[model samples]
Target: MNTIDKRKLSRPNFNDPIPNMKSPSPLPDATIQQKAKTDAVDVLNARTMAILWKE
Candidate 1:
């Protein structure tokens, strides 16, 4: 049986920022809601079409 030492592991620093990384701008709340609704409607339509085609 082998034993490992926990003190030998190196921890990551979350406070440090990476260079040359760009964050994306988020969409407005209205746009986000509209997109989600559109996606749900699309999924429903696809499911309905699949059932109709199988009949």
Candidate 2:
């Protein structure tokens, strides 16, 4: 097998957490609001791109 295939096989899946790693805590309200605002901007940008592409 190639190096890429070996690397892929060695990598851990998302469900398998790394050893000694702690679970993430819940996000603060301000952080959640900031993330929501960023996501909204990303959605708006994607829609604008789609409209421009269709024209």
Candidate 3:
């Protein structure tokens, strides 16, 4: 089996305990995230408008 299949087979308990590394990482910056969300919303809204215009 592949690594993913092996993991699925023994999901509850694996060969080793889960790690607890607690190094904090900063979240994505607000402007970058806002741009991505805006792009996605624009794409969806354009598709919706196209469908409505067709109907």
Candidate 4:
């Protein structure tokens, strides 16, 4: 049996990989996260208006 050299194996370079990340302007979270944020804002606004109405 002959010994095979391991140094001939090739690998892809990673230094210039294509970016898969999303833009930062509006963030990249899922719609569920966005809905949750909106719901929280609505709840807070409603509570604030209620308190203001009572004052």
Candidate 5:
């Protein structure tokens, strides 16, 4: 018969309370960001076209 050793068992320390730090919330919706990016691109294209037309 084989006997298990009690000295090899590991235990956690319960003397201190764990920190309650929480992660930040998720980012805003994807569609809103996409709209902003598209608007920026459109503005840049309009400016470029205006400059080319003036030259």
Candidate 6:
């Protein structure tokens, strides 16, 4: 088995000084999760009704 040197690992140099910049704008609020949950429940209800009405 070959052994590796721990010092040979590469890492980011954060010791250097860097300029501060403005962060990106927040994402838009899309009520997708709520809509999906409601849609799932609607589909489930619809399937249940179909099964119950079937002869």
Best by lDDT: 2
Greater-TM-score candidate between 1 and 6: 1
Ranking by lDDT: 2, 3, 1, 4, 5, 6
Candidate 1, superposed: residue stretches over 4 Å from native: 1-25
Comparing candidate 3 with candidate 5, which one achieves the higher lDDT?
Answer: 3
lDDT head-to-head 1 vs 5, winner: 1
Model 5 steric clash pairs = none
The collision pairs in model 6 are none
The clash count for each model shown is 0, 0, 0, 0, 0, 0
True-structure lDDT of candidate 2: 0.85
> Can you write out model 4's per-residue Cα lDDT over 1-55, one digit (the tens) per residue?
1233343334444565656654455644776578888999999999999999999
Q: What C-alpha lDDT values do all the predictions have?
A: 0.73, 0.85, 0.77, 0.70, 0.68, 0.64
Better of 1 and 3 by TM-score: 1
Reference-based lDDT, residue 12, model 1: 50
* TM-score versus the correct structure, for each prediction: 0.54, 0.53, 0.47, 0.47, 0.48, 0.44
* 2 against 4, candidate with superior lDDT: 2
lDDT of 2 by residue, 1-55 (tens): 6999999988878788676554264887678779989999999999999999999
- Predicted candidate 5: what Cα RMSD to the true structure? 12.7
Q: Write the per-residue lDDT of candidate 6 for residues 30-55, one digit (tens) a residue.
A: 45556778999999999999999995
- Give the better candidate number (3 or 6) by TM-score: 3
Instruction: Give the C-alpha miss distance for residue 6 in model 5, angstroms.
Output: 57
Return whichever of 2 and 6 wins on TM-score.
2
Clashing pairs in 1: none
